[model samples]
Target chain A: MEHLPSEQSAAVRRIVAQHKERPGPLVEVLHAIQASFGYVPEGAVPVVAEELNLSRAEVHGVVTFYHYFRHTRPGAHTVSLCQAESCQSMGAEKLAEHARRRLGIDFHQTTADGRFSLEPIYCLGNCACSPAALIDGELHGRLTPEGFDELVAAKAKPAT
Target chain B: MTTTVYVPGDAGALSVGAGEVAAAISAEAKRRGVALDLVRNGSRGAYWLEPFVEVQTARERVAYGPVRAKDVPSLFAADFLKGGTHPLSLGLTDSIPWLRSQQRLTFERVGVIDPRSVADYVKHGGYRGLERALQLSGADIVQAVTASGLRGRGGAAFPTGIKWKTVLDQSAPQKYVTCNADEGDSGTFADRMLMEGDPLSLIEGMTIAGIAVGATQGYIYLRAEYPHAHAALKAAIAAAYQARYLGADVAGSGRRFDLEVRLGAGAYICGEETSMLESLEGKRGEVRVRPPLPAIKGLFGRPTIVNNVVTLTSVPWILAHGAEAYANYGMGKSRGTLPIQLAGNIRRGGLVERAFGLTLRELLYDIGGGTATGRPIRAVQIGGPLGAYVPPAHFDTALDYEALAAVGAMLGHGGLVVFDDTVDMARMARYAMEFCAIESCGKCTPCRIGSTRGVEVIDRILAGVDGERNVQLLEELCETMVQGSLCGLGGMAPFPVQSALKHFREDFRARV
Candidate 1:
């Protein structure tokens, strides 16, 4: 087992402590841990399981089951393209292809430069404006290949 | 006198350019020294007019839209703050033909109120239902809901009052009320809109439900994708708690109702009530078999009242108005207005809350203004991933549950996703199986294995490899999956594929 980072361990402990009183609070704990660290660290699972009084297998089972939880550290920004029906109707597939080629990474893979990670999202409830993507947390819709490129470039720029 | 300006903070509007428009309006107003209060209201369901900016006049809120950041200065120059006549100036917000003609009971206050404000929410008839619910007996409240003719708006047309009465009748010491806000349907945003736009109504509805069903604890299982809605809900929930509408001693009736928002981890199956219950319990969102319906045994094995956001939100209106008054709208057994979302390739993609009898043709041509591509509309997928691809030949079908079911289609979640002539039905058919394969919980053999085979068979037919045999095989596989699957995720997944084969078979055949 890997050693848990001090801050991550502390954050996980705080989250677990906060929600441990609520009935079936494992999911809430996981959400908080993920919020603290962009991804749920594998080492923290054992700690959470121990704190929540469940076996490590149970925690691992939940962590792996949901698509939203990431076992590893993600890139600086996660770009999720809507892969549902509405987005498909508005040329989402073509835009997704363009996104992959432009970023030099496939879905669920982070770019080597560590600026972005591409993922497929079912729907962001932005169906009215199709061809949608959620960059980090901000949603962009009616995206073209060119618009996507500009969006990524802008996000990649460091804050002054 | 200070002018009150309205800009939508709705996700759809924000996706376009509402944020920039709001900022520009603020900056221009500050630069020109115009006294004004900018309120970020929800969308009016007319997305074609978004970034729709409205100015509150004595008569009504005047509207302008598809507004850009650059258009702000020009709009001000045109004296838009005073409801001046500009090219984009749409006269009263409610007078818009698309919004005016429809019946909006559940969504009456959606775009009209400041979502985060408790004061604003109350000012617009928010807590009338909860107040009324507090006075009535638990059984009496359930009876009123029953008489209102309300059903589950979550694609499943199960009667809402019946579900509540079951829970109300349950002898369980620990009953719960759960709002299934996990709206993963591709073309549906009514749930999200309601939660974001008029969250207080949903809060009030849930509170009333807790009072009616004798349940103190409530959980809203929301999808992770809707961050904007999440923020709005959190803020509104806190405000609701502060105002004493939620939490212990709700409205000082000595009833304790505590509400929490639980996030679903990107699983479409979680939208399924049983699966949603499972997710809320901090497990994999696997569907639980029904015997003891959710009303009997659910959410920690309690008699839980599991309702969709729309179904629960409709409670406030039903309780506030008399049951007969609420039942006055709509036709046939489906006696209520449905918030039909016109999405996908439609020109005017937005939410349309109307009486449950509008024709598909009226929604498509008259309301939506045809396809966004301006091409001839070929098909429309009502409901989400599991819904059928309806052909134009059946456009005259009335928008009711039974009316749609008669035509081998469903009014699932009331989302009408339009598709232009450019669509290939074969590809769409493949996506149906693929979506099922990706989302199925693997508890059932037919759904777990059959969906994969369905995809492969569709591919073979698409590739023209013994196309005729594969098409027959695909149909057989769809039937098997439909009969053998555990839940709606697998059961209804075949609807799209079968509908495609039935309505658009030419697109299924090999290129010849």
Candidate 2:
């Protein structure tokens, strides 16, 4: 296993310690680690397993089973487009195609510029205004190709 | 005096730019020197009319809708604060036909009050059920729920009282009350709405359960998709703690009930009760075999009462109003009201909470205003991803659990995702299989393997490669999954495909 950076290892230890006392704290601990760092670093798995008194395979199995946890670092912004039945009825598939072409990335892939990572979310519970997308955790609905472009452009703008 | 304006902070409202509209209103208010008390409340579930702005006047709350940031200046110019007229104005908020027609027992305070304020919650009849529950014995509370005929609103339709009673009967000292807030269904948003709008009700409901079942701990297993709801629930739980509604001594009754919100990773199977329990235990969200129900032994090997967000949220209403009052509203078994979510390709998609007797036609056309695309209505997918699709012929079927079951459909989560005439049934059937393949927990072979086979068979049929044989194979595979699967994810995943084959078989025919 690759050696984790000193600070990243310390951060992982801190997150695990914060939630290790709860009834079932593995998922919560992982969430905190992901929240602190963009994704769960590969090196932190053994550390979490050792701290929680579980096998390294148990922690790794959990990380792979749930779709929410990420083993890799994502782009600067994450764009999750709804691909479920509700959004499908409102042209989500077409919108998804447009998103891919515009972003130059497919689902689960980061853009070449590392500005955006695209993901397919089943539902965001924003079905009322369908063809929804969550860009960097902010929900946007009634998204046309044009609307999606505008949102991407706005997010891509550099801070002054 | 400061004029009060209400804008929804609901995810649905925010998705359509309610946040921008709120900012614009505040900026405009500052510029005009108007004394404004702008409040970000929850959505009314009339999502078509969101950023559904309401202003509190002396008489009533005036309504204006679908407001954009650009419309703010014009709304101010029209003196909307004093019930002024504008093109977007829809008169009094309460008097709006769409909202006024339905019975909003569970959602009464959702769009009306500030979500985070416990004092505001108390003022609006929020804790009345908990207060009433505090006065009664656990058995009496359970009996009231049983008498109310309340069933699980999370697609299973299990009796809420029986689940509680089992936990109440358990001899275990460390029992739990887990609210399944993992609302992963495609068209469902009622759980999300209530949590965001009136989270105190859910907190109150869970507290009542904890007090009744002799459980001291509660956890809300929320989905990770709803960050807004997470924030709302966290804030509400804090306020409830600070206000003494949730702590070592809940509401000063000297009974202990501690509550916390635990987030679920993006696993659709976690919506299932057993899978949810496993997920809560910080493991893989695989479905557990029944006979050892969550009520008897669940959540770290203790008696646990697992109820949906809507089911738990509805408890407060049943306790506040008498059991008969709730039982009086619905048809036969499905008592009380259901917060029916109208979504997808519909003109007026939103949450419509009503008694259980209304026909799907009334909901789809009268309430939903038909398809948003102005095309003829084709099909409606009732329930979630695992639910069956109903054709236009069955649209008149009443929205009851048994009525829907009679028509080969289930009222799973009371979500109606409408589709227009342009929809291709064959493609939808394929998507169903695909979704199952993606979300199946791999606990059961029939679900894990059969779903993938189902998908491939559909693809072969669609490609015109011996269509008849492949279609037959697909049917056989579905049957295997239905009969052999351990949980609903595999069992009911075939419902949509089977329904499409039964109702719209021509969609499967290969075009030469």
Candidate 3:
């Protein structure tokens, strides 16, 4: 099963066992498999359908309902930065421009070297410290062009 | 230990270099041999009091007005720390009407506690709801939520209890609670504030949801926009797991609920429930036609209850205070408090959580103190981009969804963006179409190609493409997009366009 990758292959069996019992067992199973591998690979759709006793169309429909699921591998580091009014008020748009120019990537694209990936986050709750950005789940506040360079450099250095 | 911070917590504070102000506090304290303990707490929500540094002595935290780092030395010599009364002192920090008057429940612990400290969270009444939830049967927990009347705060005011009940009735062995933290509206920052200020409330709410619905897992569908909220959540989650509030066991209750935060790309459409599920599963964010609502079918085709950040965050308060305590506060059918975001050219821009019956006059005039420009306020757009444009004539309308809808507007997330006379309504109208066009997922034709053509039509109208004919064309396109679109991006995009055209017809005429 380790070689089987994610628990997605068991989705059909899992759903079938629980489908008659409840209406939304599908969302649960999908979340489980996705949590394990970071993304839900396609090979498990039929497994989900067979288990839930729902048509493939029905199962696919559920997977397509929300935007949280991922079918591909995300880069090593995901950088989600604020683009809301409060952040924009503090020149987040310009900071985003600097980020795009420096990282050589747009809002959602990963870099060629796979060193970092950028994601546009709406509000990081760090409005008190506006123009906030997160690198690999670590929050950085009061970001400027100079601050951005030092932080990105720190994130990219060898762990050892 | 002994330092002063005049944080306005208003967007204006950050705008006018409060960041440098914060840095200056650190450097100045080190140089002066004074101790500085700076906390980036939530906005006291007072805009006029911005860059307002407060000095904490033994007795009280004294208020200092709009002090620049350039004036720190003079402030020190003036014995401002001794509270000897400087020219800039605004008296007491908590005495300000904006800070003193709010009956903050959802935002109670925020800006006052360490966001990632589980101990601080528990000390501040964080996981009491989860503990209460574990003691009750799932049905009983659902009853508590139903009685609270907590509705989705991400635009739509759908009752959260009904959504949770649908998933609860589903007998699926697997279930999921998805928190939609993708707050993309232009003038809103409440979600980010809650996350950074008091993250544990959200975690506790999700945990309670998991126990109430028998779901073993939860996911926070955070937008790519908030890097700070994401980090705070991640650190808080790790702390929860270590403290046994999360992970396999869930604090010795043996309920076995685990949570993971999945980050979104820059897609705004994903904020929609179904589209959020698709993107969470790692696919392009496209709207799904609902027969299987996320309550019946969501996330990975399992029974999932998708809720907004406020919807989830408010759960702990409801469970702790009981349904009636919350239900008694609001005016009409709109039960409980709503977080109102004031932004743009407003005199006082910040977040205010209040009971649901405040009027636009009260919001803009009394609380917001009108527009900052000192110019005449032309229009106010409530509920973010999807909400209607309220001309000054309509400012007296109440804030309830039904009432707002009656006035051709909706109380969508209660984001009020103030625009002065200088704002070009025609340009704003055109930009609305452009935003929809760029952000549309292209799954359906009305939202996809229609938005692109919308840009062209608006541009043509601006360029004087047959006066009457162009206006007719614009109206026709808006109707099609509204009636035929698959999701909100297309369905609600016409609101701003139609509103601008209806109220400010002269602007369009001038462009033509």
Question: lDDT score, residue B128, model 2?
Answer: 94
After superposition, candidate 1 runs with Cα above 4 Å error: A1-3
**Could you tally the backbone clashes for each prediction?**
0, 0, 65
On the 0 to 100 scale, the lDDT of residue A131 in model 2 is 82
Give lDDT tens digits, candidate 1, residues A24-131.
998888998898888899999999999999999999988988899998789999999998899988999999999999999999999998889999999988888898
Candidate 3 on B1-512: residue-level lDDT in tens?
45544443333345444666677767776788887667655455554555667766677767776677687777767877677577787777667676666767888886556566788788888888787788889988898888987788888899888888998999997999999988877777788778777888999999999999989989998875565577778988888889998978887987788888877755678888898888776555778898879898887789998998888999999888888898887777788998887776666666788888888888887887876658778888787666677899998888887788988998887778777787677777877787787778888898888888988887887888776788889899999999999888899989988998899988886351
Off by over 4 Å in 2: none
Query: Candidate 2, TM-score vs. the true structure?
Result: 0.99
Provide the lowest-lDDT 10-residue window in model 1 chain B.
Answer: B503-512
Q: Residue B140 error for model 1, in Å? A: 1.1
TM for chain B in all models? Answer: 0.99, 0.99, 0.94
Q: Is candidate 1 or candidate 2 better by TM-score?
A: 2
Model 1 C-alpha lDDT per residue in residues B301-374, reported as the tens digit of each score: 99999899999999999999979888988999999789999999999889999888999999999999999999
Candidate 3 residue-wise lDDT at B432: 76
Q: Candidate 2: which pairs clash?
A: none
- What TM-score does candidate 1 reach? 0.98
